[model samples]
Target chain A: MPRETSRDNMLREKHGKEIDDIISRYPVRRSALLPLLYLAQREQGYVTEAAMKEIAQILKLTPPQVYETITFYTMLNLKPVGKFHIQVCKSLMCALVGSDQLVGWFHAKLGIKPGETTPDKLFTLSVVECLGACGTGPMMQINDDYYERLTEQKVDQILSDLKKTGACPLKSGPFMWPEARSAK
Target chain B: MPKHELILLKNMMTPGYTGSLKDYEKTGGYQALKKVVGKVQPADVTQLVMKSGLRGRGGAGFPTGVKWNFLPKDYKGPKYLCCNADESEPGTFKDRQLMERDPHQVLEGIAIAAYAIGAESSYIYIRGEFVLGAHILDKAVAEAQQAGYLGKNVLGSGANIQIYVHRGAGAYICGEETALLESLEGKRGLPRVKPPFPATSGLYGKPTVVNNVETLANLPHIVNRGPEWFAAIGSAPKSTGTRIFCVSGHVKNPGNYEVPMGITLRELIFEHAGGMRSDKKLKAIIPGGASAPFLTEQHLDVKLDFESVAQAGSMLGSGGVTVMEEGTSMVWAALRLMEFFFHESCGKCSPCREGSSWLTQTVRRILAKRGRMEDIETLKQLCQNIAGRTICAFGDAEVAPIMSTLQYWRHEYEELIREAEAHREKELPMAAARH
Candidate 1:
């Protein structure tokens, strides 16, 4: 068992109300584990060891249980990632639509392969399976946004725009929240 | 022959439709819920759905009403309704479109389902990657609740229904109903064994009904228009209603198209999707998502309904019609699909865990030009061993790509092996000369 640190106490204080709201959704506190993990990821870049311990403590489970759940999911990263985590869809539909070539193009331009963050920590390239934008294949998700119907030229433009303004110009459908777009 | 009417996607085609609750209500969205809540009994709602002949859209094609009727009438524990919005199938994106474009329609469907099943609380287990869709659903649910459509004696019917959106953390198996429930309970998405199906023992050991998003989305139309009207829309008696076919890969216009259930595959591909991209000769098609068996050009005229597609040696699994052209490599395609299944296997059972990994490595070896002639036989044996031996339908699904490809295109695999051997033979003398 890892000892509690001051950072854990700070996270608890910051997200205490949100954590309570998440726990209240389920009949069992243990069921709040995944949402709490997402909250922890939002606090930090990834699910750190201390955060897992804090989540386990909050849900009344052991650290090992939470760790097992984390390992099972591909999205819940155990280590730190870059600011813009670019996950290119490499499933059957996307691959057929040239996602493999898109990944290769990213590798050549970014000077980094899949699963590696750049020295500047601005980009992390990963080839993930099926983001459910099959019709608009060869898609990639940067942070919370999905950039679909991609070509090499589009990838070039997106990367340059992100490098310049910290945001990509292209916007595709099946958003995490289009309502937020209006709010912004 | 009357043209097939779009029920679920009617609002989607409306220009400048923002998928708002107001927009949905203007098109008569929650009128079914308003009518059914306080007036109609739960059993009557189930009967109406059964008579409408609506089946599950998330692969299995199980009758939705029959599934609802499975919950023991005598059980005293809290009944739950879980709307499965975790649409992660490789070629399937219909549910995502429905949720993102018309979320209130989906919620209205969920409310109706909750009323029919006597579930006071319902949850939509959306895919983790669908961040935008989740946010839209959150807003839609809140909007519906505020409008007296979802929470606290919904519409003054004395039926308190609360809907929550639960996001999954990027696991494909969570789309499986039992695994979905397990994940909703905040655990690893390993599918639970059957015989104790969700209707009896589910979600905190209570009676629960799990439904697909598209399946539930049809509830409003079925309730609004009578069951007879709904049934009359389909080309066939069994597969009654319009289905949104997601066409991708080598199609000129790759997108979701809503058509009657019994439309032909050729019509879906050429007529609706504007034919193949670049006028390339069509080689093969996976009529449903990655899980369905691969169909060749000979099966193009087959109907797109659940029963007809099954009769043609494939399933209308999620209606993800993935078209492949002549220049495309079948071996490479199968390898990529095998890679997906291998990565997604839940590892609860030995057969799927070992078999998917083994098949993936074998296909990779073949694609790398290192495969022997005997490897084809080994691949078939592995497929045989994996199917029907696992906890869920995943084992059978994982084998579909391999088995179907081998059945339809054995010569492609053989040709690759022959080319590899020829290349190796050419390299041997040069190696000896260098030495």
Candidate 2:
């Protein structure tokens, strides 16, 4: 509905066979919507109208159907987020262990609040539900990787490191949320 | 500390155990699948699991074998075994660990469960945020297929067990079985009304079995060792098997610990999890996930079994023990969990959608020192009205924190209210003149 900048069917054109493979896995074509949505999000940072329309066409659903699903899911952004989308876990487990402080540190460092992207479009901050990394309480997911057991200094280092290297070396455990010292 | 025969997390804790096909095979995995696939009858497999006294690790605590048997006996067309990897319950993280660290264990379990239920294909509906876990599972599924443990004619048993990992796009309600089925159909994750459970009609209108990751991961181990072996392991008869308690919050060692089910809350916290982070005395414990009711330090010796925890006014719902020290505020904790519920309430049912917001606001107001004594009564009525009125258990779950807190820590709520009353009284005369 916003300016339809992405006119091309980039989702279908680029991820045709891959999409086909995913669709084939399910008995119904519609079931591939989540996977295709993921692909669209991966191809671009956020899902575009053109992508949703294309997904609807591919899955044989109405645009509203696709739009409704997009709206329901928190991860599927309607607009483009910054290069690094930092989703801080604000659920009770993380809350108990200084996630609010982690959020404050992010605010001070980024000059932006939750649900806002930086002017430079480098980092986007959003408060999210538990990512199930409960043990390592004060955690955030920057794009795909998790940055856990955060402190003010660690948050500063992570941001600075991301700004410099396009990635944070402190990103942790896909499998294990290691002890703070061991993680470092 | 008492010993635990950690079947689920054993391989991951082993020295340099790569979770590859080779590593899983070396660790005596898939032996159960091979033993049971063609040799054992489907009903008999279910019987074996039933005998093992295995119950669902995901909140409900329903017997896994009984669940498998619910699939319409012989009318099966396209039955599904949906592994509920949507471990989004706040304070629960055992599923992510199982999938990421020991993918084959889960995959093997899925294969066995599918064969047991006569389901050819199974889908692991993993939480979308678990990107690494999903990727690991995808690779594991591929590896299992290549090794003939999955795909057409598994292990020459003529059992075509195929496992696929499906990712949910950040909806906690999708963790609910019927809601999960709806999402699997690429629709909004709204729950369907009961009468026709997933076992009767599920996943594209066929019979289905939705199971938890931790529950399914136990299948292979149960099959390898006899039913008697598993049944004898945990708290007798009812609650059987090792539970991976995700100890978080104000704990010295806040991590996953797989122990026998009968351990007391005190033993779990003090011995297994290394006690409170500081010298601050223990205040409260949400013995299960955020959905379960909160327990105070008085419930320290309450055993972590499903029935015992339920007897203590909380279910062993997902085994996510969240400890809070004396410094923490219970009302604030309730507010935090209420906020999560308010955010995640899929607006299918009016009671949940509207009640969650109201509950959250009331709790928030109390925590912020702006609440009245009447608001406490309002909160109680709201929780009561909402719990049993929804299509899903979410209604009951969302109210757990508020209801439990009000029950145990009534004094804290009163203290806040009294402060609000005093503050309001002081400001009243000045406000009256201004008005």
Candidate 3:
């Protein structure tokens, strides 16, 4: 946590134009901190010290200011994680409809629990707060896609598919309810 | 059942409407924006929204039109309107559906709001977890800009309205308006004190107006069909327009149901949501989102409006009706929701930061059969100290589950403690017998 191993700007060389454009969107330069942190994370799997320092320099704040913002958010990881990050919802709606069992299957198959990464670095599992997909309980968001209404079979299929091809074609929902009536 | 027409989500539930700009334009979207801009006085638009009696759909239920009027009339600098799309509350998915299915509806709504407030720019503060919804809104914004609906000189009305999509990095407290402003400023999402409430000074210290996703989405409708039309739909005198209730938990058909505001909770659960998921008797309901207190079976017949739900001693917050069946444990349920509050407390205030931890530990101990008889009293006391003691409503919201559950289901807590007591008695006697 010292400045002895300090690294330089990690994003400017690659994302100069994008970074300038993002900073210009706001009146205050500090307002671009969250977006830059996201870009840093996207470039690297997790937010590194160099990237944090780079963002601080761009936003014109001290390193601690950027570090504090990083710690406040749950999505910005401090360390590198697996290729497929599995975030299971553990809130009331999902819990009532057996999200616990979904956690259990992760234990048996991946041999990992929430907040853990598999030894092979292929998957990481976390039990997160509600993802606003309450109606579709027993849901997990892998990377960018949400895998909902999950069964053990579906979980198995998703895992095998991700392991083999790094992708799954299972139905991801933001599906609406009550069949949209024929436009009268 | 009488059919109440869908206002916000008319063709959204159907497959034909793609939510694209062209698709939205065809379905009479942005026509309201076209009709109003450069033509109607900004004051007149505000007047129409005031007359419609539309309230904030995001939990607090403040009047949408009245909130717009609070901005300083002649402030010369830059004012802003922020659309809150950070829908992370447990059991609430209504905003997510509205954004993904009808991006332009929300975009058009933002444009109308910006013109009314005389702001040249607006931002949609969406949550980080809504990857798909953000992508959809980003695409829709580009499409609207290309079609001359959102950029400078929108629809040739000489109205310069630009909308930006900003994403939050996973903080539940960011949903609070003050905290949301702070988060938007690239700072930690902490709630600021009131009295200089958001209307006067907000979002980098300007006259900022923050409206929820569903609340702003109603503007185009209010402009298109007269306020009298929307005013007559709901409970009428007060809570007007249809509310999209996100029905989850043990319901047979758990999804978003858009109905008029005055429907009975019984009609929503037993009829609209297709009853219970199983044959089990329904025991409890959280009439709003996670923040609302639990209402028992006796309260089912109460009208699902803001005033009536408040009269029934619970809020009609966020319209997230989470149903729980008979076999579900109230203590465990409260514990799950409590953990969510404790984890997302933001640690800015001591009472919420510290009190949530105590409440969660106490509730967990009671549920785990390690609770003392006095733990029930401890739980009640912690909840009392936490509510109304913070910078925002989160303190009050965090305590609702604990306080409300204890009120209606004290017997459940007592029963669990009784079991623990019996176990202790058996252990003490075994040691005595050994001696």
Candidate 4:
């Protein structure tokens, strides 16, 4: 039998109550797989093998079942990503509005290709599909926030701000929460 | 219509309408739920929707009332209402606006649908990329539960309804009803074959009614204003009610415009969307989301309704209008759209999976100046093979861009091949000199 590592034990010990709460939302425990995977990704930087096994055990699913779901979803990362993952929208609408140029700019500035993490591990560059923010084109999502209507100058400013302060200073569009409610 | 009477998007444009349950209540949000529970029969709500001529806004144009009526009448099992908040269609973003700006509106719609369909539990399967929208909905569901609108014995009618938000992990196929059921069941988002559709057996082998976010958002107004008022809004009889047209790409003011059905594409682009950007000459237009065929400048006068657009060799799919200027390359556009399809094929069926890859490769070769003259016909033949073979509409959708572009711009492909041959001939001399 395979032994349990301390990391696995720690993850379960930390997220036990929250995992139970999420599982309780659905009639079947297997239905909670996606949300539990999301929770694991949130707790760790990305979904690790240990995290998948732990999630499977909690949801009464085999680890292979959990792993298959993890592989299917684009949002769930298997390997570790940087603290701030910058995903640029490269779909039809965004592509029409110079998302290719935006991707080029990120490559030049970050010195990393689309699916690569920087050496410092501060940022990872990725090109994703339509984030449903097509109205505001040339958009990029850094962590949980989106920075839309991008220009070279805006990209430079955003990168510099991120480098200096470890945070994105720019705001998302009017459709986002908190700011959306207050906007006219 | 003077200002396009807005039903679903009424609170969206209002100032200080912060999507709060309180603000939504002020605008008469949950009144429909209050009236439906213990007051109106479940079948009557379906009848009202049928009278309203409400159709699915999620590209299918399926009659909403007809779909709700498909559920077995005295089924003893637990029924479910799954709201398709997974708006990942390439150019469609209207549902995101509705959910982000007026979350309670959608929640109230879900509540009413749950009551009307005799569903004890409902799930809003939202896209994973909609982080803020999901958060807003989470808060809205909690607020509704707290206010005695969503939880057990909802409004003291003895009808229990609980709404939960399920986030999808960035797959476009999940927007399809059965694929959505599969994803909700914690499997890959592979679309299932019909005949045992979601209305009969869905969400763990029970009767289900999967609805678009915009489709459900119209419920409150339909119940309050009566079906006749809703049916009278649109110009067309079959496609009734206002549709939120998300106009993006090359328009001066690219945003969501909630206009009445059957509005002219010319009016939607020139008047409402502030015309084309930079005063450039228009070349092509994608009247719907990426799945719909591309229409040329001649189609500017086409009506932006399902039937009219269908007559014009396209669909009013999700009402996503994408405009392209004169400088845009038709080959490049086709290639880019093919790239999207190739990436999102889901690989459930061989035709969609392998055909999309080959089509993408052919288009990329053309773009890279390495394509043969016969490749254009090859692409068309491949599209013909793929469209009607797959289990879902995705197979048909994957061919729209290639087929439509080839129909309108065959000369463009010929010109590209000639240019490539000329460049290659010129390079042959340089190769000789180097040798």
Candidate 1, residues B67-127, lDDT tens digits: the string is 9999999776689999999998889888988999999999999999999999988999999
For model 2, the stretches where C-alpha displacement exceeds 4 angstroms are A177-184, B425-435
Candidate 3, residue A63: the lDDT equals 94
Model 1: interface root-mean-square deviation in Å: 7.2
Instruction: Report fnat in order of the candidates.
Output: 0.69, 0.74, 0.80, 0.60
TM-scores of all models?
0.95, 0.97, 0.96, 0.95
Give interface RMSD for all predictions. Answer: 7.2, 4.0, 2.9, 4.5
Candidate DockQ values, in order, are 0.46, 0.58, 0.63, 0.49
Query: TM-score of the B chain in model 3?
Result: 0.97
DockQ-sorted candidate list, best first: 3, 2, 4, 1
Instruction: Score each candidate by Cα lDDT.
Output: 0.88, 0.89, 0.90, 0.87
Candidate 3, position A52, lDDT = 87
TM value for model 2: 0.97
Model 2 per-residue lDDT at A42: 92
- The residue-level lDDT of candidate 2 at B225 comes to 93
Worst 10 residues of 1 chain B by lDDT: B426-435
* Residue pairs with backbone overlap in model 1: A175-B132, A176-B131, A176-B132, A177-B132
Worst 10 residues of 3 chain A by lDDT: A1-10
What does the lDDT read for residue A184 in candidate 2? 9
Locate the minimum summed-lDDT window of 10 residues in model 2 chain B: B426-435
Best by DockQ: 3
